[model samples]
Target chain A: MLELLIVSTLNGVLFGMLLFLMASGLTLIFSMMGVLNFAHASFYMLGAFFGFQISRWVGFWPALVVGPVLVGAIGAVVERFGLRNVHRHGHVPELLFTFGLAFVIEEVVQMIWGKSPVDFRVPEVLDFPAFTIFATNYPAYKLFMLLISIGIFVALFAVLTKTRIGLIVQASLTHPNMVAHLGHNVPLVFMLVFGLGSALAAIAGVIAGPALVTQSNMAALLGPILFVVVVVGGLGSLSGAFVASLLIGLLQTFAVSVNVSLADVFAVFGFTPGPDSMLDDLWRVTVAQIAPILPYLLLVLVLILKPSGLMGTRET
Target chain B: MKTTYVRGLAVAAALSLCSAASAQESIKIGYVDPLSGGGASIGEIGLKTFQFIAELQNAKGGVLGKKIEFVPYDNKLNPQESIVQVQKAIDAGIRIITQGNGSGAAAAITEFVAKYNERNPGKEVIYLNYAAVDPVLTNDKCNYWHFRWDANSEIKMEAITSYMKANASIKKVYLINQDYSFGQSVRADAKKMVSAKRPDVQIVGDELHPLMKITDFAPYIAKIKASGADSVITGNWGQDFALLLKAAADAGLQANWYTFYAGGAGGPTAIKQTGLNHRVFQISEGFANIPHAPAQEFEKALRAKYNVGLFYPRAVNQFGMLFAAMEQTKSADPKKIAAALEGMKFNVFSGGEGFMRKDDHQFFQPMYISSFGERGSGEPLDEEGTGWGWKLVGKIDTGSTMVSTTCKMQRPN
Candidate 1:
């Protein structure tokens, strides 16, 4: 039991950290723009496919740098054209624009990349086990994913806290009108933040692509979870986003790691189900059996228990 | 000399017309699937196989002296959107369609294609299924316009049960399936198989999950762990199959034996999952690890073009059957093609070549049982460590004869 818990928790932590990489960028954009980027996950998908394509021509390192850069540029263009046009309609409009953009992006990707899962492989250098527990070896690539998230987190903290541009960005987040009056290029700042946020998402995509099974829906699959993370952490708080992401990630990872059915609970109480009972299948429900639903359950619970979220300063 | 040469050439050309005259007609076919999703591996291989055959046919001077053109589109497993693509192909006058996708989407096309054939009998929209295995496709729900390139759900289960009876000591059966039509039907088959073959075998657990939404299996794994089942039967395919093996191993739900009817069950993904957990025989149709000489050559040509090999046996099975249908029908005429395919018997060159059951339009192919070898110790070389390699075992035919569950069904002549 202890071994299982230890392994599950470790796997959860690693998965949580990976989720943080994807969430941090989203939170930053949300805090700055006041409107959630519904297509943030789509950028992540772009990063993966772009990186996979780039690697074929120029190899892995170049893809590691180029993939995110390309995705960031696309994100900036999308913000300037797609989102800007829709910004006038209000927050819902902006959100709806991104949603439509997501569908369009999915189609465009299929057109360019063709329909097929690229046989993506992590570079040979990072291809060994980083750690092992209970006879199970954890791959170096996943460990690298955890490290990259942490590294990005640190870099983001440094940029946000130590730089002059950081001060202007923070000022804009608090008072966009005031920052605009102070001769700040608010739109440029918005573009930069959006680009940076998208680039961060792309980086996460590059790392997770080989691990999570890359496909057209990779972004859409992560969309709801990332949204849930942002909402659960409190829409406007970075710390809240971080906490929520890790929490949800770990919750899901662990939930799927172990299972025990409801029948066990019934059996303990000396309740035996008859063969014809509709509850026959239920007598065999397990926590691990329901792993897929755990994150949403956590989201609902958080929503009910703390409307402001763990570290939320703003309310939606 | 020039006059004599000209006369000789003219006489030789006139003499070339012989006893068996080759038929002629140009036809266009369309291929659709989520070629870029988690299931892309199957779709991609199927496409390559399609191309190889198309190329082979074209090189021999095209189908009916009019080259066959196969234009493929990506559906990405979206149903409503897939219908749009199919309609587009239909509008462009594409008569024959080959599709391998989720059952829901396949069923949607069935109604559309039937109507398509009815309205435009001049260009009958005949469907050749390569991957969708819903029994309703060839059973009571079957339409005369559509024919399956792959086996039905009941046929695959028959192979599994028949192989198990001769192969292992499966006493207790625990079924874990993705919750849907195919999953439910697979569970039903297993239940029936147990009752029919080994009534003494207790069914300890039966579980279901929504398709493509399964994230964890610990609770189910824990139940199965406690169930003391001797073996497991499932319809988990692709990513679900891969994830389940990891979950079972992680949750320690090891059975004496396990059986599944999936493209990935005996493919690379299963091999990867088995590496993480334990040894497993990924039950597959067709017993060959790599198919015969013609199939191996086809695989080489395919890998050269697509940069990947066929992971699912059905990818090749469906390709071989459809290509064979097109080659012999020789005429791209929809009615003629349908006529040729009905009661079609051709050597598939991929081990035992099975005939398409005329009554039900199901392929009566043999199955392959490939056991996944354990993942070697030490750190995985990148994602390759998760690689699952399958080892081949005995081959058996599931009695390719599909007994029609419906009395109303009849063979198309």
Candidate 2:
């Protein structure tokens, strides 16, 4: 029991960190631009594919630096040419633009990489066991991912709060006119922030790709949970995204470890639902069976209780 | 006036004769499966396999004096899309349609074909299922128009559990599968069969995770590790299986995995990467490295030409029976072929005697249990450049592999 708890906690924190890695950039883009980038996960997918391709040419380390930079450049170009024009139309068009962009990106990735998963292996240096806890040998690659995620969180927090460029970017969102009058390029700030956010997501992808299945549909898989994290964490709030990511990660991980069901609860009261009953499915479903949806359930609860989210300054 | 009328009649007769000759040019079998979207990876392979089989058959002077042609229709792996495709195929005058991939699609196509045949008597269309292994299709929903070449999921579970009965090492088993109809059935069948076969074995855990939705399986892996299971049985395919095995490897979870699709696309690569040599077992009708000389020759030729392994040896059996039935009846009519196929016994590609069960139209064949590992001197094949091949461990003969089917079909008068 102790081993299980320890392993589940470690797994939860690691998974939470990975989620925060992807969601942090999304929160940044949303808060600064007020345009939810639906294609954020698609950019992450591009990172993984790019990382795989570049690593094949050089190695994982070079791909780690180059893949995100390339994808970030692409993100910046999209903002400059595509999103900039869409931004004039309003937030709906921008959201729709990113929505369609996700599909197009997925199709393009499928066409180039094919639908099957590419073999994106972890670097040989990080393939060993990082530590052993009661017989569970956690891979060094996961520890590296945890480290990178933490480093990204720390770096991003510092940049947004403790840096001069951060002030301009933050000011550009709410006081674009004033920032522009103050001789700052507000549009350029928005473009650069979008690119950096995308780069952060790419870094997550580059690290997470080897650990996860690097395939075409990967974006579609992670896309929804990302939104769940952002919303439950209070949209546009980086710290909220961080807390929500860990909360969900722990919730799902701990839920999966538990096999108790409503039936067990009913059994204590000396009642059992018949197989033919309409509520039988609900009664019989174990916590482990419904672990995937627990985060969404949390989303519902949070939205009902606090519409602005756990820490949002404004409602979305 | 009489001479002119006679000449007009002669001209009309000649035109009809030319039309009849042109109509017998080729036999077109509609290949209805996903040819686009996420399912396309396997769909393209299925299409190529059928085309290759047709190519081989047509090379031998064709079947029943006409060349075999496969007409591809992209269903996009949707049940609704499949019905539309099948209707399109029927309108195009196709008498035979084969599909496999999704049981939901299979069920839709089966019902469509049955109703179409019932409504249109002489223009009957036959549905040949290749890979959708839902046992319900063979049992409760079986019909005369539908014939399945692949072993149903229940049969696969029976085979795996029967194999497990022999292995005394498997004291505790973990069940992890996708949380849908296919995965649900696999879980239920595994539990039922394991208990009946080896009551001494304990089921430590039964987990049904969302299908193809999970990115990281570390949580599930940790749960499995804590359960202290020595064996795992799963019907997870695609990324589910790959990611599950990957996480198992990462956490250093040591357990023998018995899977239904451990040889699917990207499966061998994942298994090889995990270094789980001979530990990841799969039960299938046939694989590339089965020690049959003729099948191996066929595999080599197939790989040399298409650069893909013979992933569906039952496809060979499917076409073999198809051609034989056509030859037996000396016709290409769907009704005649369906009749000739019932309870027909034939030699399978993997060197076994197999037959189509008349009750359910489900083919009965020898199933092989193999594990991915480094090849011995005798094994000359590897999968997806993994430098690892499936080593045959057990072979369940056709008779032993047969399970009872509760099928009652209404035959044509």
Local distance difference test scores for all models: 0.70, 0.89
Error of 2 at B256 (Å): 1.8
TM-score of each: 0.76, 0.93
Error of 2 at B79 (Å): 3.5
Q: How well does candidate 1 score on lDDT at residue A27?
A: 88
Residue B41 in model 2: lDDT: 62
Error of 2 at A63 (Å): 1.5
Number of the predicted model whose lDDT against the real structure is largest: 2
lDDT of 1 by residue, A189-273 (tens): 9888888889989998888776665667777778889888888888867777788877887777666545477777777899878
